[model samples]
Target: MPHRIAAIQKLTATEPHPERVAMFAIAGDSASGKTTLTKGLVEAIGTHRISSFCTDDYHRYDRKERKNLPFTPLNPECNYLEIMEQHLQLLILGQPILKPKYHHADGTLGRPELFIPSEIVIVEGLFPLWSKLSRATFDVTAYLDPPETVRRAWKIARDTTKRGYTTEQVLSDLEQREPESEKYIRPQRAHADLVISFAPVEGRSSLSATILLRPTVPQPDLHDILTPATRDAAHIKLIRDQDGKPVDALHIHGHAPEAASRLVEEKLWEKIGLGGDIPASLGRISSTERSAPLAIAQLIILHHMIHC
Candidate 1:
């Protein structure tokens, strides 16, 4: 077992599953920026310290077989939920699992890959938080809910460019998956400790992210971190969430001057150093260039994972 998981077990000895591994669940719809966000966290924490998995791998049928099925892949019936739950339990107990691999490129099932438990196991996919049993396995949960228009654009770009789908085919597939997404996907948002939404700001072409820090988990003190950054320039705020409950709503401007984001980064690093040093490859998005707001978001998640 990884040292961090062992240390956590020693620290939480009295709790159930005292030897449980630290796990994070990132749930979202198709192309909802799950992989983009997960990549940053892995980089910040050091890839060697984290073992990642996707619940989509539990799909019972290959892509071609799914074409004849009545239910979509998003439906629970289409996945090996029982096996996933069993494997998750094993992972929490510091055991290894012979995991199945689904090749996205050719729509074929590859050989089972043996994955041993690590200090942190990141589970990201369409249904990581879909069940109560699966939900209990995570130490932290996040849901990505980008605007529909923005998500569609992202999905089209990804599917056409990487997944070998034409633009029209991708759009048609999305239309067919809408009902499943609404039924089995979006509802997972309520179970998240954080709901992240990235979209273009009004009157500005640059994209910005609004992170809703829910009360379900402990959050960093951005107020203390933003100390001298002045409210006018720094967009961070602690306000009521949509449910009328008090929550910290952090807004990171995409095109904001470097000094503005740097101020926040400095304070964040001051409070919690980036695993000793800032990672050189952190915060990369879909494009080659990195976004300051995305980097800050990654830092926020890394801080919580270490300090929570």
Candidate 2:
């Protein structure tokens, strides 16, 4: 929470720009839907207006090198934290950075590439809000806090299918990473303006989403959209957070009728005042599948990007 004070102080010390680039941070453990959530926002905002990249690229060791290391990639010591912070500051100032690349498929360090910031910048990965200075760079920040069982399943699925790991290997790596995840990764949730959790509803195939809207930043007023008529699809209520603070919690049911979810989406899109149809790219889980809860979550975040 000290970082929040630092963030406020830093913002007040700097001269505001009329065309200042808005920056968002999505922090979470490995395969906790950070990229998926960021992908939707980029598509909705347009690639020309937003630039996004993973902070995992700052890892100090490659896959081969990590085998002998004592700490996992989730540890702050395992990444170039200072460099990542510097690059983030530069990006917020509308400057370019020669960003490092980490190849997720093979776990190798790739060539450094030039990264230019656009009207909006989304930095997603494990350590975007790890430090006070780093936390000060974002206009909005969110943390994905999926259930451990669900996250483990997602990690296993992604690693086996795309990263060429066997089911057993992925499980083993997850067990090893759990301690670091608890120590370094989960703590960042405290720094986020929004904390998102996506979990399977009982007897449902798709995942329902729960978002905690913290008072750290201005959030969209959803009282008009979350009426009893839309309760089957989405609703909002005051709840006590982990820290015992009262916060607004928004729940989007995955099993809700398509029409019901669409109505909520329409209301949110109108609130965004973008003056166009909702982006077709919202809610896409894959080329073939989409989740209404995911779509609604993305729209709420998009609302923050435009209105907040």
lDDT by residue (tens digit), candidate 1, 1-308 = 69999999788676565344788888999899888888877766766787787888888999899999988888989989899998888888887899998877777778999998778888999988888998998888889889999999999989898888899998889999899999999999888888888888888876788888887888887777665563423566679866688877787777777777777776776677544666645567855677777777777777777776
The lDDT of model 1 is: 0.81
**Residue clash pairs of candidate 2:** none
Q: List the lowest-lDDT window of 10 residues for candidate 1.
A: 225-234
The sequence of per-residue lDDT tens digits that candidate 2 reaches over residues 59-147 is 99999999999999999889999999999888877778999999998999999999989988899999999999999999889999999
Each model's TM-score, in the order given?
Answer: 0.89, 0.93
Q: Report, for all candidates in order, the number of backbone clashes.
A: 0, 0
Q: Clashing pairs in model 1?
A: none
List ranges where model 1 is wrong by over 4 Å: 1-20, 228-234, 238-244, 274-276
CA lDDT, every model vs. true structure: 0.81, 0.91
